[model samples]
Target: KEFLQWYIKEQGEEEENSEANVKNIKEAGDDLSAVDEKMGTRGG
Candidate 1:
């Protein structure tokens, strides 16, 4: 039960992070190449 609760919390955090990244990418618009380069270097 403890592991299940922890896993759910982690998943929620990951989802939020992913959504934020997507939003950032979308907002980058014409500068998407820069975003991709940054993410690639960060190994994200």
Candidate 2:
């Protein structure tokens, strides 16, 4: 039960972060390539 709850919480956090990143990408109009490159660098 404890592990299930922790797993659900982690999933929610990851989903929220993905949502935020999508929003940022959309807002980053006319410069997606630059934004993507920066994100890749940071992720790598």
* Tens-digit lDDT track of model 2 for 1-44: 99967766776689987677667667786487788889999999
Candidate 1: the clashing residue pairs are none
Lowest-sum lDDT 10-residue window in model 2: 21-30
Residues 1-44, model 1: lDDT tens digits: 99967766776689887677667767787488787889899996
Model 2 C-alpha RMSD vs. true structure (Å) is: 9.5
Q: Which stretches of candidate 1 lie over 4 Å from their true place?
A: 1-13, 30-44
Instruction: Please give the clash total of every predicted structure, in order.
Output: 0, 0
Report the Cα lDDT for residue 17, model 2.
78
Record all residue pairs in model 2 with backbone atoms less than 3 Å apart, i.e. clashing.
none
